[model samples]
Target: MAYSDIQKTEFNRVTENLIEITWTYVNLLEEFPRLDEQDSMSWKQMFVAWANEFEELYGHTNWIESEKTYPEAVEEFAKEKILQWAGIRKYICVGKHIEGITLNPYEWLLEKGQDVKLFESEAEAKIYLKTNGYTDEDMEFLKFEEVWH
Candidate 1:
């Protein structure tokens, strides 16, 4: 049987995240069918096997690890997840200068500061401030265009 829409979407999402975070390669269409036929498996089963195969083939290291002593590996994966999401979302941070210090908008918001926010789009930021108790006189919008090096 051919892969369903949901299966295809999920396979794509998982593989894309894996590729972005781990730089691993997995060709879904070619590999999925082969794996499924070889094992007589469903899409979900095939997907899990595919992921495990990637980890085995590409996620190996010489160092030994355990749950108690190697928490950093998990931490590193979480960090990479955050970075991958950030890269995909392309969020722009809105922060006010405070005490001559500038912080990331996300950090400022997390600290309960009212002057900073994060938004995926400039229009959303303007709309949020307009609706959330900020008057025209109380707020000034600053746009920082990103420059890629």
Candidate 2:
């Protein structure tokens, strides 16, 4: 359905309602594949991509959550799901920011024999890895990129 055919009021109202319902359903489900952890990355990526597509089609922004507290069910579900998605091993998210906010906690990384570092920019992070002679395979799990840049 093209927006051109719909009345402005009707279009705006329906877009708002649909966005709310979509997010509610995603939050409620929390984890995809219903207890199957092996398929998490593919599932989450597909789900997020679908939501992103919907937002584009409707000409609305699906706001990224700042943070949220989850009930026991959702929390447990995410914990297990993430473990499986990341191969039940150590991984790190390197963000280039002066504030030094990490995607994963220090305790979690240390427990898995992993090291996490935050640089002022992606270039710095890559240079550090190269300087340390960390081959691409060795640094395969460390991702550095400007998501929107």
Candidate 3:
């Protein structure tokens, strides 16, 4: 599926050192209905930063917040945490098809001294990796594929 088609999802690393974000709410209240208080709290802690992106994307503060329950607040907190984990200071606009990365967006990454590459195709991204200092050895470990797919 495409990023636009995906309602909600997550990206997590298998290693303990790397951040792990699991998309547990793709179908919202359908496939996984009724997030228990405990499960919701865990999700909040794990994916808080990601949730924040939605708020920014929508350009509004959360109108429906949970004050009576800690889980709700925790879920919101997870949004911020998710971004922190992704090393993103701000969101950036990338090439239309390139999305789903948890890290800072292209412009933000560039501003922060990261080598940001926005390409129209994966082939372009690969070429950039090769010409811009990446070697075959380095390429082996990097995943250029779009994660949202």
Which tens-of-lDDT digit does each residue in 5-55 have in candidate 2? 886644553344344434544553453434354355675564455444444
Better of 2 and 3 by TM-score: 2
Please, what's the RMSD in Å of model 3? 18.5
TM-score of each: 0.28, 0.25, 0.23
Candidate 2 local distance difference test against the native: 0.44
Instruction: Point to the candidate with the largest TM-score.
Output: 1
lDDT (0 to 1) per candidate: 0.43, 0.44, 0.42
Two-way lDDT contest, 2 vs 3, winner: 2
**Candidate 3 clashes between residue pairs 3 or more apart in a chain or in different chains:** 10-23, 11-21, 12-20, 12-21, 48-78, 48-79, 49-78, 49-79, 49-80, 49-82
Better of 1 and 2 by TM-score: 1
Better structure of 1 and 2 per lDDT: 2
Tens digit of lDDT per residue, candidate 3, span 85-134? Answer: 43433332223222534363432113245645445466666676688787
